[model samples]
Target chain A: DTAVSQTPKYLVTQMGNDKSIKCEQNLGHDTMYWYKQDSKKFLKIMFSYNNKELIINETVPNRFSPKSPDKAHLNLHINSLELGDSAVYFCASSLRTNTGELFFGEGSRLTVL
Target chain B: SQQGEEDPQALSIQEGENATMNCSYKTSINNLQWYRQNSGRGLVHLILIRSNEREKHSGRLRVTLDTSKKSSSLLITASRAADTASYFCAPFTNAGKSTFGDGTTLTVKP
Candidate 1:
């Protein structure tokens, strides 16, 4: 019974690869977010979607896209992934209330060689 | 180039000791949050302190916010070996955005 779940816990690919990571939240949260944790453990927000509507989109590369078919799911698609694209990606969801206490999914570790 | 920046980069402490990590931010925040991440894992939310509030506690986690200084601190009391993880501080602004810092790697020895 996980609140937030992500598929493909680990992914390994060579340069110029295309991959997708799927995430789902059963907590009925309205807002969902994507974060990338770099080698130094620096986690940064890449995108945020509220009820399938784009809310916050950081300056991530255009090749990195986040698609939310519905309020319950958000999937990330990376096209032509580069070496620098290797990182642990986390999917989180939270209600748009004051608490803003997020529920995060087990991250998907992406390795690009 | 995130808004929140954590100090000490790393911390080591003995079990049963209190561990503290500090974070400074460059912009005004609506709230500050602390999360713990096991090595190569996802981060779990620990505590959150709002701009109007100064401190908050959850289990062994204590979080303090100083909006005037644009900083926050997380205090873990009676830390155990299980508490060994990378601790991150995140600050959320009015723009519906939360930025995280390069977490402080914490190692608790038994």
Candidate 2:
């Protein structure tokens, strides 16, 4: 089974459209994270959740919101996406908040035209 | 969160050659980890080295940590074309956050 899986492997939408990506980890980890990778392949952490609690929130815009209904799941919703939002979003999970190795999903590619 | 800055943003080497990448951080850290991401794929954990450890080896990979200088290096021996990927070094602080840098893109020529 895939340890960490994400839905909608690819997304293409208009600039003002809103889209959501879902992530789930079967590894039973306590912490999950959302990362955004730009065209240069720079991975930046957007949000982090530990046991369904928001533990880390970067300086991302309000248009980006993360929801964790449970420890095993974390979803990201982008509102009124802009052309700058065109990038790859990755979902990752770890055993602890800031320690250990991270298991990452295949990622969701988002293109805002 | 401590982000490790990787030196030589890109690297190219022959299949039988060795490749070395370096990472430097500003503050103290609990441990450091290396990850490899193939094109169009997610990052995969390569190895982890603790603050106290100076050197570690896993298969053909060797990692060294110098906490005094707050830097780490990853060495891959006898590289193969499959080793072509972007390598990232994440420096983890005890303060409860891990951050990665831009990463070193390694291209192992056939």
Candidate 3:
């Protein structure tokens, strides 16, 4: 079974479009996060939810919003996507106790043309 | 700006050779971890070394941590072609938040 899974493996949309990516984890982890990997292979944490509570919110643009209905799921919604939003989004989860280790899902590639 | 910085942004080596990647962070960390990501895939956990620990080994991969310098290194011995991937170092704080550095892309040629 895939421990962590994210939908819309590939997304190709025009500029100013709205898109959402869903992520689910079966590992029963207490913390889930959304990460953006830029073209330079630099991974940055966008948001993190610990047991459905927002814990880490980086200085991401207001166009991106993250929702966590529960500890097992986290979703990202991009509003008015722009060309700069073209990147890979990865969903990851880790046990609250072992925060150093993370289980990541197959990334969702977003292409804004 | 506080994220870890990996050295030798890209590397290419023979299948049988060893590969090493270094990471330097700006502040003290609770632990340092390494991860690998293949083309178009998510990151995979490799190893984690605590600040108090100096070195750790998992299979053919060795990791060293120097808290004094806020630096860490990952060494993969006898690398195989299948080992070609991007390696990232993440130094985590006590708050369960870790920042990843720009990864080192390693290409192991057969």
lDDT of 2 by residue, A1-113 (tens): 99999999999999999999999999989999999989988788889999999989988999999999999999999999999999999999999876779999999999999
Note the Cα lDDT for every prediction shown: 0.88, 0.93, 0.92
DockQ of each: 0.64, 0.70, 0.68
Q: For model 1, what TM-score is found for chain B?
A: 0.95
TM-score per candidate, chains pooled: 0.95, 0.97, 0.97
After superposition, the stretches of candidate 2 with alpha carbons farther than 4 Å from their true spots are: none
TM-score of chain A of each: 0.97, 0.98, 0.97
Off by over 4 Å in 3: none
Model 1 scores what on Cα lDDT? 0.88
lDDT of 1 by residue, A1-113 (tens): 99999989999999998999999999999989899988877788899889999888899999999999999899999999999999999999998733568888999999999
Mind giving the per-residue lDDT tens digits that candidate 2 earns over B1-110? 67889988999999999999999999989899999999999999999998889999999999999999999999999999999999999898875577789899999999
Model 1, B1-110: lDDT tens digits are 33688888999999999999999998877788888888766788888788999988888888888888988898989999999998888888877687788889999999
Q: Which pairs of residues collide in model 3?
A: none
Which pairs, if any, clash in model 1?
none
- Candidate chain B TM-scores, in order: 0.95, 0.98, 0.97
The superposed Cα distance between candidate 3 and the true structure at residue A101, in angstroms, equals 0.6
Best by lDDT: 2
lDDT of 3 by residue, A1-113 (tens): 99999999999999999999999999989999999999988899889899999999999999999999989999999999999999999999999834679999999999999
Sorted by DockQ, highest first, which candidate order results?
Answer: 2, 3, 1
